[model samples]
Structure formats: structure tokens, C-alpha cells
Target: MPAEERGKGPIVTSTYRVQLTPEFGFGELSELTGYLRRLGVGGLYLSPTLQAVAGSQHGYDVTDHSRVRAEFGGVDGLRKLAGQGFRIVADIVPNHMTVPVPESGNAQLWSVLRLGPESPYAAWFDLTFPVALPVLGENPEFTVDGDVLRYWDHEFPLRPGTSALPLDELLEAQHYRLVPWTEPPGYRRFFDVSSLIGIRVEDNEVFEATHRVTLDLIDEGVIDGLRVDHPDGLADPRGYLRRLRAFTDVPVWVEKIVIGHERLPADWPCEGTTGYEALNAITRLFVDPAGADKLIQTFTQRTGVSADYGAVRYEAKKHVLSLFFKGEVDRLESALGEPGLHDAVVEMLAAMPVYRAYVNPGEPPSAEAVRIVETAAAEAGRRTDPGAVARVAHQVLYGPAEAVTRFQQTCGPVMAKGVEDTALYRWFPLACLNEVGGEPDHFAVTPEEFHAFCAVMTPTTMTTLSTHDTKRSEDVRARLAVLSELPDVWADAVESWSGQVRFDPALDYLAWQSLMAAWPIDVDRFTNYLLKAAREAKTSISWIKPDPVYEAGLRDFCRKAVEVCGFSVASFTAVVDRYARVNSLGQKVVQLLMPGIPDIYQGNETTDFSLVDPDNRRPVDYAFRRALLDNPDDDTWDGQKLQTVTACLRVRTRFSADEPYFPIEAGRNAIAFARGDKAVAVATRLPAALERRGGFGGDTVMLPPGRWRCLLTGAEHTGRVPLAHLLSRFPVAVLEGS
Candidate 1:
């Protein structure tokens, strides 16, 4: 087998991502392998399959890593898949584990609790010694009610053997100090999730202990490679990557989110990131940059809010610190021991562009990290105290390494909650541009920029359009991108709709627009999305203190909004579908044939118009997709999308890693590129613009001198053919050298 086929280089064939749960575990996956193979998928990229918090749908909150969860069909199922010749890329959460209750199945964590510092597993977790960890109420008040220790509404049940022990004695025996769930935990956690405690994986013993099962899988040939989840949360991301590389020669990709112009650390020994940047890039290519100003105007007119994402993000981050993470801020303030430092620290964290800087223990912080902090501090200093700003910046830039590490750890959750969770929903400048790690302010990615990014990272990057974590599905976002092209029509339609019904105008604008994109959308899905969106926005109702009145009002408004907007939804979907048909096929062809390795999210090959989590992670209809693949005559949009994806993947397998990439200039309405002599991809980026130009306006795409045939339709074309002729059969074209 070639190195690429062995998961050493780019995953030349595509990877299909599956969200595994008890509801849809290894048995279902095992059953789907032949279908996946038929669809040309090279590997199965699975969600965390380890034993987790009981009944958790997403497996990130792992309770134990020693073995697969029984609910997921365990070792037998894994071997079955491996026996069938499917490559497996497993997601590993090295940063944290589920904080197990005493009776839970996690032996290591339970052992630490029972044996204190003397436990062999004591070094596995990060804990503050001799301090009572806050696990319940603000005050250390607990009542032993039989086997359960109750604090307010919370309960920590003792194990069967420990039921006879007194509550104080039980508490004293634990290595960790449990306190009320507060911010800036005495012990580190995975963001604000108290139940998922951070581990000391940087410790060699801990690394060996936690990764034993996974390494065994790799050695046994059941697992081909690893996907590192949230390496930014670790104390040393670089060190961890080095350690991960040492254990296996199999390919590894980190779940790192690189912000605007932020490059991945060249030194980290991994394949590349899990492709949010690529997702953002491909999605934005289809958006019309010409409509940015008009959409901004329409957004402000309809919603009465500024398109200033930075300001909104800053305020939202501040809200997170004050409202949700008070304990964390308190911890930072205590660490600093200086007046007015908390405010400055929050400002600096809010301004951080990337997730966290990997500052080695002995070295000064990287120039990039220092620049980000100093710049944020300087900007904040103009409004606050210079002395305070300097002190905070100094502490971050030149302080003890652990303090910096703590702040870096704190930044991850703040960004995830405040930016991705809150501000993304609140700021609806253009919902297409609103994605995790996306900069809404950046607007669009030019061909030059997209190609440059590919040049640097394509060989190892995991290119994707949608994932389980995306805010919206690719097709939904594709429809929303239509609004950017037809701002006048969108604004007029929204204005007319707003006059018919009354709700939160900001949310109304958001809901109505999204509803149009996801039309043929049902009431239950719409209602669930609105509730989650409202809570995430934290405007009228929040997760902490939900306003029942406002929620009822929002719910009623959504039902009526759907009723009122039916005609508009029909009309918008008609127009948007035309554009989406082109965009969906375009993105599929481009992503699969682009420079990087492409990953197909389950069901996304069809029309996956899901909204967000729970919705996005729903079960895939393999029978439907399989039937579509089996019979290629149905020309529906879903069938067309699957056909386009399969065709591109087929052509992609012929590509060699040695091929030099050449960007083809195909005018403003399209983006085209070539791989050596044998393969080329051309996708329509702005169909609306093409309509305005009456089709391609004599724009010519340079081919490699001779005849090439479309891989999907077998339409042949010669050198410098008119754009219209090249894309006459399909909106996107993937051609092979004849």
C-alpha cells in the first residue's frame, strides 16, 4: 500500500464522519460499511467511543478510556469493522475525563477519591492539595442523607462500601478538593463544564495510562490513526503533539481552530487541523462579496444593531466573565493580587485571536501571543488605567508560566461560550459567514487567499463542508448565502414580514431568514432551534435564568412566524434552491478535488439541512443514500449532490501527491484550479453574478493544452473553452485528462 493509503500523508480517498452513540453505534456502522465503500469513502471517522457519562449522546465527556463503551458494541464491533477492511481514525480526548460519581465505573478517578494523594492514580488529575474542592453550594454546607451527601439540590452519592463512612471522612479521603461549582476552579476543567475535569496528561505516567487502550488499538491494526481533540486546552500543546507522535507512526490531526491569518504551529508533529478553516473558506467562496454592504445595511435597518462583530464579541465575553465565570475571574484576580487587574485581564482575553499560545515552560511567550495581549491591553488601556493594563499584560506576558497556562485555559471556554455560542447567534450580519472559528467581519475569501491557505496546509488538512459541531448544515448555509446576493429582495421580504407579526425584531430577522433557508422545515425543528438560538444569544431569555414569559412569547411567535412566512418561504426556497443547487454541487466538487484531503459528514452528501447540534448529529439514512447510489437516474438536488460527490471522489483517486497545483483564472463568477496534468476542478462561485452577466461573459479557463472530459458528465472540452460551455452540463465540473 502507498503511504497515503496507509494514513501517512493526505487521506487521498475521503473520510466519512459518524457521530456514534448507543442509539447509533458500531452495529449500525458495521452494517453501513459496504454502503460507505460503495459511495467511495476511504475511512470511518468516528466520534469518541469511550465509556462516558451515562447516556450522554456526544461522547466527549468520557468517564473511562481503558475500553470502548459497551453501549457502542465495544471490542467485538471494532474488530468486525477492521475485519471488513475499513480504516478507522478515532477521536481521543486527552485533555479531560468525566468526573465520575463514587459508584461510577471509572476506576482511576474513583481510586483517587478513595485513597487521596497516596493513590497510584493521584498524578493523573490536576488538583489543589489540602483545599476542599467546591462541588456543590457556595457555602460548604452538606447533609449526609443516607448514602447520598446532599448540598442544596445537588447530590454526591457514596459508593456501596463507603455508605457507612461519615460525610467528613468521605471528603477527607479524596485527593481533590470539591467545592461549589464555581469559575476558575481550584482544579482545571474542560471549559466551564465541571463534570469534565482536566487531566495532567503532560505527566508521562498519566499519558501512558490514559492512552494505553488507544495505542493498543493502533498496534493491533484496528485503528489506523488518531484525531487529537482540543489540544489547546493542554498545558503544552506542542509537547503533547510530540508525545502523541512518538507513540505511533499513524497520521494525527488536531481539533485546533485557527482564526483569521493564524497559522498552525509549524513545529507540532501532526498531519493538520480538523478543517473548520477549510469549511469556512469553501463556504465563503460561494458568498458574493458585492452584497456585503447592502446586507449590513439591511441587517441594521431590520434588526437595529451594528455589524460590529468585535464590539459585540467583546461585550459578550465580558458578560460571560461577569455572569457565568465569576469564580474563574475571582481566581485570576487572586492570582494577580493587584487592583483593577480583572477587568484588564478580561479585555486581553477577549482580544485573543487564536485559541491559545503554546508557550513552553522555560521560554518567553511567542511574539504572536505577546503581540495579541499587548495590542488588546493597549486598546483597553486607552479606556481604562494604563498602570492596570501594563500590570495585567506584564503578568500574561512575563508572569510565572502556570499563571499564563491558567489564563490560556480560561481563554478556550470564554471563546467557545462567548464567541461561538453567544455572539455567533446574536450577530446575524450574514449567517453564512457565522461559523465556529469564522470571522464574520472578514466577509469573504478571495481565490488568492484560499489558494494560499491550501498551498501551506492542503496535503495534511482535513477539508470539510459540515461537521457535527457546525452551527448550521452546509445546505442551510448555502441557502442563507443567497440572501447575501439578493439583499434588496431579502430586506423587502423581511420588512413586509416584520410588519405582519411582532416578536423580538433582532430574533425575528434571524429566525425569518434562517426559516427561509431551511424551508420545508417542520414546526418542531423550528421551535427547538429558536429556543436554543434565543438562549445562546442571551438577550431576552438565558440558559441561567430563562424568562418563561419571553420563551412562551418566542415560541408563539415562531409558530405564527412560520404560518405568516409560508408564502415567502415558498418563494425564497424556490430562488434559494436554484442558487443552492449550484452552490452545493460546486462545494462538493471543489472540496473533494481541492488540494487537501476531504471528509464527508454523514448524510451531508445528500441535502442535510440540519440546524445545529442534536439536529446535525441525527442518524443518517443509509438506505436512502445507498438507494440513490444504486440508481443514478433520479435528478433531484439530493441525487445530484451525491452524484457530484461520488464522481469527484472517483476522479480524486487518480491524483498523485507529486502533482503541482496550478490556479486557473476563470473570471469573477467562478473559481478553478488544476492538479498536474490529469485532474482539474472548476466550480461556479457566484451564480447570481453569472445571471447578471448572461453567463460567463466570454470568460475563459486555461486547461493543460489538450482535450479534457468532465468526470461527472463525460463532456469533453479543449483549451481556453468559454466558461458557459465548460459548465453547461453541471454547475460544477471535475475533469480528467483524456
Candidate 2:
């Protein structure tokens, strides 16, 4: 294919969690290959496929770099599937590898652990002490050795005898039984996660070993591209990426988290980041900041917490520092050679002009930022070692600022207001909270803005709507947009039921209920599981265990609330019915019409209302997808919806054959674009709450003279019709000019 042909239409791709065998079977790759081609997807963007710890659902904790995972049909299956014409984009983790314990039976990892810092593989891992030391959390009496650590196989320990001694005791042990370190006295590791020992991939040898398998796949034409995970964790990402680029001409994209105004390194040879910024921008555009503020105030008043947003933000920072930073600080202290060097580093970091917590590259500071650190040092009542204080301060300021900001944005309201009578708070931060400070106006990409972004994109760049990490599924977000228009109705419903339920962490509990109604999940056993999760999160914040009395009351309240809200036992059933039709249609619209390559997450072309992480990585029902694709005319609603989306996908593939490019025109609450004289696409983002405006061209972009006919509804209009009327039946239109 010509280079221009590759860049022409939106590239449709799907993300498959390698661990979810049911979602994308290694054995069924042949079947999946045919389906992907039929669906017109140009590529498959798979999650990490390297051998991971057993039962590892998301596959980030890779155990080996050389081989494909047996759970995902291994090397043979992958190559066979790649032969089917869909480009393969493999996700690779270079920063770290899973620490192998005894039970894993991996002699190589065990050898590294046993040999400690002196082993040939020592350079592959980042460790602080020359001797392997046990990591301590809350419990302080346990110990972990090479043999013992390897013995412990489960996620959470069950019995002391079943694994190594407890973690604390391992730290206190005088002599180590595990791997001994080769480094002098002090060494450093990444973040405090011992199990996830960082690698020195910047080393030429380490880089070759890590890239060998991937490069071989590329050579065989089995893998078409790469997504480098955690680029920030590496010491020299720019150099590492450039080196990788030297090996292959395949497209490479870095998974870099964009914190505020941070731009990608100009030297890195990659297309673009996986679209988190785009997601953040699009989501913030519709969230009601005033409403969020009101919720915060209401919660604060109810809880008697005097801390404002900034204060709460500080507290969250302190919490993370206490939990995850001490080890990193110790490592940095050792590296600097000076006594109290950690504090000095922190002081300099706090005083630095720019915040680059993870990767600091600059000169030693003047005294101004030091003065601020000194004040903090004095307040702690100890003669704060200036160096130590500075280091700690730097950790606080730079280390987890983005995560802290995200948590503050999401949980500020919950922390401010105590949960109703239960006096509990929401744990971590809920997704709803993060939507604040993300006002659409803050980063919304209008047509002009999108054009600016597009101007920067080479034909090799990737574009997407949903990914494995997105807070809400794209279809869910589209439906949630309806709420922006009908906030009053939702508010009224909440008000009516406010007095009936006695939920601990009241606001969060109520919020969960509302979320349940808004995005109805399976009401069978699945509903019970979700309800249990809600209760668990509530109790964690409340510092209380589940109570029978409260559980009964909650059940009763839910029943009454449903009754009052005119919902039936069939409410969830009704929701699923409508959601199936609407969301499926919405997916088809986005997949086909959106500019750039449209990437579909594993199973997202159907209904996937999964929450973040583990939830989103659940087993895919490939059988269902296969059956739906095979029987496009099935009578069932979900099957019908699937057929509809598939049909539209087929049309998009056919239309894209001619290689059409569209230029957009803005409307009051709508957007109009033309694809030559053959077709024009019009889309409305009408929030139900916004007043219905005079039509597409009132004060919006004036439409050019032409007779246009709506493709879906066949309505004809000379010049421009009232957008409100045009959009009453359809949120989007693709008009074929007569």
C-alpha cells in the first residue's frame, strides 16, 4: 500500500488485555483475524503480551521478556493472527520486570535474587542496598528472604508458614538469606515498590535484551508498531526511543502522562501520546464546575472540615509522601554522597522554577526556595537537616503532584462533607471528582483547535476515543452528556430521595446510587457485586464494617427510591434495552465519522461500561461477538444493535475506499462539515440543559448556498434549516448533496 493510502481513513483498532483469554483467545486468533478484517479495523492495539505472573489480568507485571504468554496462545498464535492483515501494535514495559520469588520456578529471576547486587543481571535492576533488604509497610516484624519471597505466590499472604517471614522482620534481620548486593553501601530503587525493581534499560546490553524479541517480531512483519509504557520511569527516554527507532521503521507511541503544560520531548521519535489529554479535554468541557463547587461546599458544611481545596490537596500530598516516598528519598540520599543530601535535594526541588519531580535536570539552587524549605523544617520542631528537608519537600512538591491534583479534583467534595450520619468519607477519589478543574473551556479543542493539533500530526500518528484506562467508557460518556442537559431533573430526583436513605459517607453512597441508575450494569449477580463494592468503599472511608441494620435500611431505601422515581424491578432491564440501541448507534457514529484513525478498545464496539483498570480488563465474550457478527440479522436487541454498528462500519469502509476528506463548519449547538460535493456530516452536541437554539446558522457559521438532504431521515432543506429541528430526531447527520 502507498504511504498516502495508509494515512487516508480513520484507523480502526481495538485494545485487548492479553490476560483476558476469553476476550481475545490465543487459540481463536484465526477467528478474530477474520472478524477484525470484516469489521474494517486496520490494526489491533494489544495490551502487554509478555509472560506475566500467573493470573495477572492486565499483564504489566511481566515475568519474562523473551517469550509470548502461553495464556494468550504464545508466539505461534500471534504470528498466525498477524498474517491476517491487521497491523499489530504491541505494548512493551522496559522500566521494570516482576521480581521472581521461589514459587514462580523461574531460575533466572531467582538467580538474580539470590546473587543480589553483584550478579551479571544486577545492572538490569535498580536497587538501593548492595545487599537485598526487606521492604516494610505497616507491619514491622516480618522478614522476606530470596527463598521465602519466591515461596509467597498469592497476591495477599494467607499463612506465615506458607510464605516468607513477615516483611518487617525481614527488614530487621542482621544477615540476609536472599540475594546479596554488589553495590558499595547505599544504592537506589524506583518508587518503593520492591516487587517492581526498575531496570537500567539505558545500558546498551539491557536495551538489546529487552528489544530483541520485539525487534524480531518486527523483522518477521508480525508486529507493525509499539507502545512504550512508562517512558518517564526510564533515565533517558529520548535516547532509548531514538535507539528503538533506529531498529525499525514501524510507528512508535509513548505512554507519557501529560501533567498540565508538559510537552513531549522534541527529540523522541514517536507519533503521539495515547490520548489522555484529549480525553481530559473532552470530558472537562461538559462538566458543571458550579455544580461541583456547590457539592463541595455542601459536603464541607456537613462534615465540619475547615480545609479548603488547597489544604485538602496538601493533606493528600502528605499522605502519599508518607506512604510511597521514603524509599526513593533514601536512594537519592545515598547517591548524593553528602550527609543529609536528601533534604538538600528536596529543598532545591521545592525551590526550583519548574516542577520536574520524576526527572530533575538542573543546577544546585540559590537560597530563596531553600528559605521556604527552612520554614517547613523549623515548623516540624526538629533541627530540620536542610538537605533532608529539601529532599522531602521536593518529594512532596514534585513526586506525585499530578496524581495528587487528580485525587484532590475528584475527592475534595467527599472529604469536605462527611457521609450523612455514617460520618464516613469516600476513599481515594471517585471519577466524578476528577471532572472538576477540567472545564471544557479549559482545554476543549474546537474545530480550529483540532486543526492546529492535526497540523502537528504526521500520517503515522494514532487517534482514539476509548482506551483501557479511560475513567468512563466512550459510549457511557456520550450518554452522560444527556445529563448535562437534564441536571435539574437529576437534582430533583436526588432531593426527593435524600431523606429516605441513611448511607454512611452519605454523599458518595447517594452518588453511587445515581451512577447505578445512570449506567445500569447487569442486575443479576453482577449488580450485587457492584453494590458490595459501593458498601466496601463507603465503609473504608467511614472506618466501619458493614452492619446488618444499615444494610437492611439501605435495601429498603433503595426500594422506596425506585418506587418514588417511577422505576420498576425492570428499571435496569429497561435501561439496558435503551442503552444497547443508543450506545451501539453512538459507537458506529464515532467509529465511522471521527477524523483520524479510530481505535476501539477490546470489546468496546459493543457495550462496555467497565470502570478503570481490573474492571475494564474483564474477560471478553468473544463468542457473543463472533455469534453477532455471524448472524447480523439476529432478532435479539443486543444482536440487532451489533448488526447495526457492523453495517455502518461496512459502509464507512466502503466510503473510505474513495478517500474523502471533510472540512467542518460550526453551528450554534451543532457542527457541519462537507466531504467534497458528495457528502456532508453534521453533528450536534446539544446538552439537554442548554436552551434549544435557533438553528445551525443563527450566530454560528453561515452555511453556503446548497440544497442538502439528511441521509438518515431524508429531510430536505434549501439553504440552512433550524438546527434544533434538524437535530430533534438525530444527534448526527451525513447529508449526500443532490
Candidate 3:
């Protein structure tokens, strides 16, 4: 709580991620400190706390930056959490603010809407005069009451002296217009969600205004660090980060998603990304790439979807750009000051490998950015007009400021909606690889490659397995990873299950995958997740385009899947259960002990079979977890997982963040790493394959020439120890060297 400790990152090695909602506010969090402390937590990583819309769950739709949300007990609650002696990393959203329906929650947005471009707050938003609000449905009606315009539970401010104007005249007289939801406007937005309008953090006054309270909190030492939300959405990511670092002296990290071999931009002044890149490396290390052919064949033949990741991504990108990104496309085309380049631009965007190019106008693109653009352009040229593509690409890379910024901003959203959301849901050969910024077709990462990734990582960068945004939990992915080693048996089970409970053929394979991975789930949970999956795929249904008949059939099929195929799914799970256990404990220990302050999502220490967002956000039964951690030697998966995670956390706390990683090559089926010289982690990968090879065949790990004690089992050994004995009790062994 001293200002002297502010800039120094968390004093401990690990932080626990908690999704704070109205139900589990600061008071509730204060209650969990005892448990977190027992679990070796050094800091508390929180969800967004700024005042968002009423009853908002995730809190990213921030409405007020000057005040914390009252639903979560506000400024006082935040102060209390900080007082609990946990270094606080407050998640702040400076990129965008919510455009709530009532329009009064955000006073800045309201003032801008009421006063047009003349308002003092106009510079805070990325809107123009006569802001076009795309909110109308068919048969739209509006009424004006004293100083207010009303539209079906939505209220807008009336301009001065326009309360008595005719309905159409009043609509035209206001500083904003209500158009059909189909007609999206040209204001900068967070991806395709028009309601969450982007803000101009490039402006100094706007940055100060939006970040005032948080900065003050940092000065007071109520917040020790910051996790920036979505920096790529900014006009100048470098300038924004530079300005951010200037304002506060604390560790800052961005929610940046880096693709394969694409490192974070070196110029950005931040620690590192929130660790999707590490997530990819950790999950893939458990996968068996040799099984990719069999899995892809099964998926393609059974579901009739393309196994070519590139083609699936291209089609998905093309579909999303046409459906939701027309505004962005039109904006880019206009900025380029060119004609007939829309197709060229869309094709290039679809082919883009990274999220966005950080090319400023008049400045040459960075080498990495150049490589990314060249790769995409080469692919785009094969499909579209090469001349047009070349023209648009040249303009975006080296032309006017508007053209460059517009192109850079458009790339992030298109990649997110197309690849991560749509294509991931559509192409599911191995669901474990279908994560954010993950390649489904590209299967495992060799231990050497994983070490290469860890070698370059900033030590303070956060590392995680399951996060609030991951497609599946660590446990779910662990279960799914087992299928790669048993693809033949999996294919036969799916083929048999397909003959019984028939849903949409496109979704049948995915449903089976999810059901088995997130087993022991209820019918409601299973069906709800499948519905979301169906919508994300955008094949049979979508969030905006619902097919009730199809949904009903899907639900009916879910019931049948439980009634008839449940036994088979259970049988299939039973066969793969031990391997899943190996993966569950292996990945958990690796994440906890690996480089970069390891972070654990709430309830992940034991077992979490959750799917995406709402499911992931479900409350942690901490009392149960506390009891389990109290007696972690009960010979169950939860007990073993908790022990392994706890052991790694305790060992990790002893080491400083600056400690280097030394990879210890164990064998073909194991990954071993020594952090500095005192701690070493060894985890089993592809346990089914290891079993096929008959238990390591005398594989051994050379310890760092000292008597080492296993943190999990308390077994001590010297020199080279056979993994068969070192990891006899569990799939993972955490050793502390003398």
C-alpha cells in the first residue's frame, strides 16, 4: 500500500484472475482473500470496474470512467480490495464506451449527440455531425415529449427548441438520426458492434478525461498495474501506449493477440501481451500432430466441411466482410481515393495473417508488417485483381494518413469475427487448436519450438491456460487433446452416434465434441452452448438470423443425444479419461511453473469444464475448492490437480521474475524446463502415445547437479532420475533444487 512499491510489479510470482460481477463484488472478493492467500496468490487481476450499463456482466461496455460501477460497490469497494494486500491490476477500457439504449448512462455521448460537433465532449468520441444511429426495426415510430425523443424503451435527447417540431422535422432537426439497423453508419466502432463506439484516445484531453480516476488511483497506490483492453483498435497504438506509460509508472500489458512467429511490435511501451500466444504454445505442446490427417479426414468426410484452414478462413472472412464489415470496407475504399478496389481490399484483408499492420502514414511498414502484408497480398492476388490489390495495398502501406489508419483499424475486427469466431466454430478437426489466434490444421508445437517461444518472452508477461475469452477451459481442452491420440476410436464413436441422434449434419460433429469434452453437463448447458456454437458458425443460424425450426430440432437432438448416445459418449470419455487426467495435470503444472507470471482463472486450480463466456463467467464454488485445497492428497483429479498447481505456485513464489528459463530435454513424450537453477518442471505430453511406447523406455531427466526434492510428492533424488520413477505418482513433477 506504499507508493514506493507502485511501479514494481506484483511482489509475488502468480496472480489469480477473478471475474467480478454484481453477485460477487468487492465484498465477496474480500471474503476470498483467505483462500487466495492459501493458494499462493500475489495479486488480484480484476475484470473491468468502470461504470457500464446496468446489469452488464463483463463490464467492458464502460459508460463512465470517472467512477467505478456502483453495482460492484464502487470506489470504496476497489479501495477495500486494494487494502486486502493484493497488488491490483485494474482492467481499464480506454478504446471505446458503450452506446446504451437510454443514452443517458454516458453523459459524454449524450452531450455529443445533443450538441453535434460543437459540444465540448465531441472530441472524445469518433463521430461526425448528424450521427446516424442504426437502431430502427420495421414500422418505426417516434414521439417527442418535453425535451425528449422516445423510441420503444429507448430515449434520446432533444435539441434546443425542437420539442414542438413535426415528427419527421424533429427527427431531421436533431443532431442525430435514427436509421434502420441494417443501414450501419460510418462512425468508428469496436469491430462490428455499433453500440460500442470507439473513442479518440489519440487526443490528450480525451485520454486524461477517460483515464483520470484510474490514474489517480494509481498515484494513491490503490492500483498497482494496468491491463489495457484492445490497443489495436486505436488510431496510433504506439502513441497511445507512449502516452499511457507517461501518465503512470506501473506495469502495463495489452490484450494483444499475436499469431505464429509474429512478435508484439517492439515499439509499443508495454510489458507484453495478456498471453494468447503462450496459450497456443502450451495447448499445442500436448497435441499430436501426426493424428492431424486422420482427424481432418474424419471431420471432412463426416461433416462435409473443408479441411483446408486457408480456404475455410477465406470463405468465412468473405462472408463476414459482406455481412457486417461493409462500413469498414467502404471507409477504407473512400480513404484510399480509389475506384473499384473493394473486392481487392476485402480479399487482401481475408488473406491477412496477423491481426493488423502497425504502419503509420509516410513511414515505411515494419519488416514484420511488410512480411505479413506481402504474404496476404500474394494470396489475395491469386484470387482477385492483382493490379487492384497492389494499388490498395500500396496505398494502405505507404499512402495518405487516412488510408493507412483506416486499413490498419479494419484488419483486427475482420480477423476476430471471421477466423476466431466463425471459422473456429465451422472447422473443428481438433477443437483444442480452434482457440483465439490458433491454427486448427497446424497441430502440435515441438518442445524445441516451445522453448524458443519461452526464451523470447518478457518475464513479466502474463501466462495463462484458461481465460475468460478462451474457447474452452484447460480441462476441456485437455479432454479434447486425448482425441488426437485416439482419432480412430473417436471417429467410430461419432459415426455410430451420427446414425442415432441426427441434428444438422454440419453441427453434428461439433456437438459430439463439446458434449464429450464438457461431460457431466446438464441438458440446458449442453443445448445452450450448442445454440451459441450454431450461431457463431453462421451456417444454420446466427445471433441476428435465428431459425426456430432448426433450433427446435437441435434441442430435440440434444435430448436424444443424452438419452441414447449419452452412454456411448460416457464410454468414449471413460476410455480417454486417464489420458485427460494426464493432460489436465500436465498442462496445469506447466502453466503454473512456466515463465511469465503465471495466472490462474478462478476455479481452474481444481477442475473447470466450462465452455466460453457466460459459462466461463459462472461463479466459483470457493468453499468446495477451499475444502479440497485443505486436503489435496485425496487421490482424485481435483486433489491431484490442486496439489500440482499449489506446489508449482509455492515454488514459483520463491523465484524472482528475472530468472531465466533453461529447457531440459527429457525425451519425446515429456517437456522439462529449469527456471534459473532452483526449480524444474516436467510434464507428460501425449500420454496415450507414451502408453503406446510402453512408459518412457528408460527416459530420464538430468537435474541441475544437486539433491532435488519433488514439491508434489516430497520424493528426493540426485543426478539423472528416470521419469518413470520421478513422475510415478502424477503426470507432472515439480522439483526444487538445492
| Local accuracy by lDDT, each model | 0.79, 0.49, 0.88
Predicted structure 1, TM vs. truth: 0.94
Ranking under TM-score, best-scoring first?
A: 3, 1, 2
Candidate 2 off by > 4 Å: 1-24, 100-106, 130-194, 285-311, 336-460, 506-514, 522-595, 622-663, 672-681, 690-729, 734-738
TM per prediction: 0.94, 0.71, 0.98
Backbone collision tally, model 3: 0
Query: Which candidate's TM-score is highest?
Result: 3
**Candidate 1 on 222-332: residue-level lDDT in tens?**
888778999988888888988977888888888999888787888888778888988898888888888899888888877777778788888887777676777666666
Q: If candidate 3 were superposed on the true structure by all CA atoms, what would the RMSD be? A: 1.8
Off by over 4 Å in 3: 1-12
Q: On residues 1-738, what C-alpha lDDT tens digit does candidate 3 reach at each position?
A: 212256464444777888888888999999899888888887899999889888988999999998988999999989998899989888988789899978877899888888887889989877667888898999998887798888997889998888898898889899998888877665889988888999999999999999999999989989888889999999999899899878887888789998888888888887778888888999999999888899999999988997788888889999999988887888889989988998999999899988898998778788877877878889999998999988987888888899999889989999999998899999999998999989888799889998998889878788899889999999999999999999998999998998988878789999999999998888999999999999999998997789889999999999899889898888888888889999999888778777787889989988899998888999888888899988867789888888888888888888887688999989889999988877999999999999998998789999987788998888998889999999888888999987
lDDT of 3 at 494: 92
Best by lDDT: 3
Residues 1-738 of candidate 2: C-alpha lDDT, one tens digit per residue: 212344423333333323334345456666766776665566677778878777666777778888888888888988877877677778899877775443244434454544555457767755533344443323233334444542223211122243354565543342233322221112233333455656778789989987798899988978877889867667656668878877776767776655344455555677666655445544433333434434444444433443254343334333433333455445454444446554454333223221222232342332443443345445432433654654555543344433222211112222222121112223212133232122222323344444344344333334454666554455555454443334444344445445554354434333443344335543332334334544433433222245667655555555544454434323533533343344335334533444444456777656666654455666678778877778755656455445544544444443442244555655434445554555555555443323444344453433445777765566876564666566556555556566
